[model samples]
Target: MPKRFQSVEARKLIQVSLKTNDLREARLLTGKMRADLHSEWEGRLNGSASPAAYPPDHLDMTLEATEAAYSRIRPKLENLAKQQELDNQQAYDAYLRKLRNTRDDFLRAKACKPLSVWSDLADRRISKNNWILPQGSEGYDTFVDMIAEAAIEAFNIEIARREGQFAAEPSSLVVKAGLKAKDDTAKDGETILDLFDRYAAQRLAEGRKREDGITQDRKVIDSFAKFVGPRKSIKGLTPADIRDWRDTLAALPPTYQKAKAYEGLSMRQAAAKAKAIGAKTISPVTVNKHLSTLSPFLGWCVTNAYADRNPCDGLFFGIVKGKNPRPPFSKGQLEKIFASSLFTGFLREGQEHKPGIQRADDWRYWIPIVCLFTGARVGEIAQLRIEDIQLDDGIPFLLIRHDESTGQRTKSGASRVCPIHSELKRIGFLSFVERQRSRANGKATCQLFPELEPNERGHIGAKPSRFWRDYLKRIGVKSGNDGLGAHSFRHTMADALRTAGYLDDEIEVALGHNQKTVTAGYGRVRQGTVKRINTMLEAITHSYISFSK
Candidate 1:
């Protein structure tokens, strides 16, 4: 009787209601109303009463199941309508209202439209102060969905920040002692696989965004593989077992301490190999990073109940001192490294991809010059694509970034435009990059120096071990603190800035380090102090290397 029932949905309700002489309408309407009230009652979705889109083939079947069940109760509704005919308009009105609510409930759950809205709504809620995600509640569904859709999963990362307090669920101790499994099935066992899986999965899930997480998992797996003797469980892992592994590794020098851990294995090996070449001690920072990668894996085993304790905990070995790290080469040493043609091993008589001439370095024998000139990190150089270099600018410059391997980012986590050294233009550095661009099949990002492949080490591009060692000797570098190492170029530039009257803080920023100088006390790099250092460095270099505006 209401004018609202005249629409297509209303007409269909009347027809379906009359299909079995109104026999099924009463029961069908009542069932739908009950379901509507129970599910998504709080979700306030108001739109034209229409069936929303359901998931493909799978949801198609669920929709049909609900519809089929509705048909079975058609006759009951028809009988109720006839019996209650005296109150026809009032009873029909109530049934129609119930039908709308029931249909709306089915539409929402079956379609998952509410999920998208909830995702948006939940993110807004998380922005509130101290809003921790609900672990396993209906509210958690939205958070989980956001992680699934986002490229970087931040869910598990929230757990890792509370590292110190994290303990076996019921215990308060940080020290790992004998622990029993919380699960009934594993009540007799000494370890908990379920907790281990939960922690590892969280670490693995967050691995995409956090590089540290990947290394953590890797350490856990490697340690587990060692302790299990192949593929056993924590029941077999013991303190003595870990000690033996440590003793074996200790017998060998910590070879990986200087390895180019970030650029991959070949560079890392070259770092260890450089020591024999008379380079000073490989950096402990490098060693520390590798240990960092290894340490968390050890921690996860105990924390997750995979093992009773960390074998690496308080495990101390002789770490090389800080003074041993490569110091900056002086002005005279830098010039010699750049000018010496004898440094290149070049190609031998029988090499497969031999060069016609003996030009051993990339960047026209001046790549090191530009890098030292700019004080740009190796990774920043490695990430430079053809487009990233504005070679056409009358005043050429580089767009530096903290871009990880993904290439979507820049360093410092911000895009910084740095002016190219005037010397770069006069020395034809940009031209060499242009030549590398034309001759190569791929982009400049594929490889910076044509002489070096992606994995080659020691210098800009050359990888031959004997060649690398011999070149260092040819450069007149002192073996034990007399000459400089590969990183000396970077250090050399920092020294150059200091000599020109720039503060230590300025030098730190020019070098692109993201750390506080607490240990050093006085020297710190901050603000745009790096650029000011660069201006001073530009003044210092012109005394030896000439370039025009």
Candidate 2:
């Protein structure tokens, strides 16, 4: 016995038979027994096995806790309400309101005679393997309110039964507690996958989440379910289960999910294969992203009564400080990039670096320049329409927006206008727009860069991003996995804005980022705001690169 368990159990010695004659088999059985005993002893020490030592007010407001609390005192409350024999529906309604007030007062003051009754019930439940709410926690208050609400609902159902309004068996209060109703069960029962599907459907119906995001979330959830067990009930999930999954993901290759050799293999198998081949595992940031998806899903499960608590909470890999994964292009690298064959002279559109007389005025020639100036995403630049370019109050700016009908979408899901830089106009960008508009022949839906097309994932930047990578390598500006790409331009722009003494909010507005501060959301963007941003955009200047050819 270990020293930690000496005081845990009063017994000086505990014994269990291995029931094996073979030495190796006996050792394996003994190991399993030791693990089980350790788990049980730890649970006892943590108050999970005996509620007398349970900490107060720490349990989150989960459906299991709320339901347990409600079930404890519901029958007594119902009998009290029936004994009152309220004469009319108005009196019953008033009684319901009174119960609601008591609940609210208990939450605010954390004291009342009614709370004493609940506290007693909580003590009884502690011995019955149920969780107790810790006082002074938000979960404690929410738990009290939910139980009070359930009591009132029970009274209402009793009133209906007395008045002959309901004939069948009384419905469970779990539905009112935000759990799925008994009758709402799916065909084979609600698995983890079913809950995730419900979550995805609700988010998609609300239009707040994008399909691409949903797809990524689904992949993570699916992998987790498979890692644990495909048919495992969500209610059985524990923090240890989530921790094991996180550790496994950190060990596997970054491309294990999509790599051909790793396909159709279990997570552990793929991890072992990766270890054998000396393949690098996933970074902390990527592992954290997986946890981010699971955290919200588990939170939703708690709300919907699929789980007791979010097991994914606080389970994340620690990222190194001050080590940026993606770095901006250096000044020398930027100079080399703009002075390359694509910017100066190229053979033709496809063979830009081969050195020919053809001046490429297509997407190949314009998107990079536009991204460098606007700090806009490559996808945003690729999906622009001819009508997106307009003169507002005599100032030329590009309207970066989302239009579902036109297959154009912004990362933030909202729209912002970016003022065209003066250098672009000096280099005949407006003339290029005129030529595109003339080619459109009055078609409002015509794309600004008509040659660029969306890929299978509906992202127009896919091809352009690939081209930029190849171009950077061909121009000797970057090498494999050095993190320099089209997105580097946005980082460069942000650095330039910060260097010019612009505030983060102003730069965020210029780059179409969703503002984080409450004050930034107070005002609507009017013409004055646009002009102010335009003035801020004018501050970006590159002294090394000249507009003149």
Candidate 2 global lDDT: 0.74
Q: Write the per-residue lDDT of candidate 2 for residues 1-549, one digit (tens) a residue.
A: 788987687877887675545554454346546887888899888866543444344222334344554444457666777777579898877776766665466455443434565555544544454555466566555555555555444554555654567563335444243333212223354777767766776676668677677877888999898888675677777789999998888889878878998988899899888988999998878889999999998899899877788888778877767975668888888888887788788877668776666678888889989988888999998999888988878889998878776678988777778889898888889999998989999786799988888787778999999999998888788787888899999998999999989988677877888776777677775222567778887898987885443
Q: Best candidate, TM-score-wise?
A: 2
What is the lDDT, from 0 to 100, of the residue 387 in candidate 1? Answer: 62
Candidate 1 per-residue lDDT over residues 1-549, each given as its tens digit: 234433323233322341223323344344544455333322323442333432223222222222222222334444554665435667666755554554455355435644344354444434432344454555456343332222111111212222333331312111011111111113222223333334444554454224344434455455435433343345444556555544433332345433453234333344444445655443444444544554565577677656666655565456765663657766566555554553233454333123344553354344456667777654455455666676332556676654545443433455555567767666677776677678676465645544544332113233432333345664455474343444556677777777788877766666665546565345442345334533655676645643321
Q: Per model, how many backbone clashes are there? A: 24, 6
Give the 10-residue window scoring lowest on summed lDDT in candidate 2. 178-187
Q: Each candidate's TM vs. the true structure?
A: 0.46, 0.63
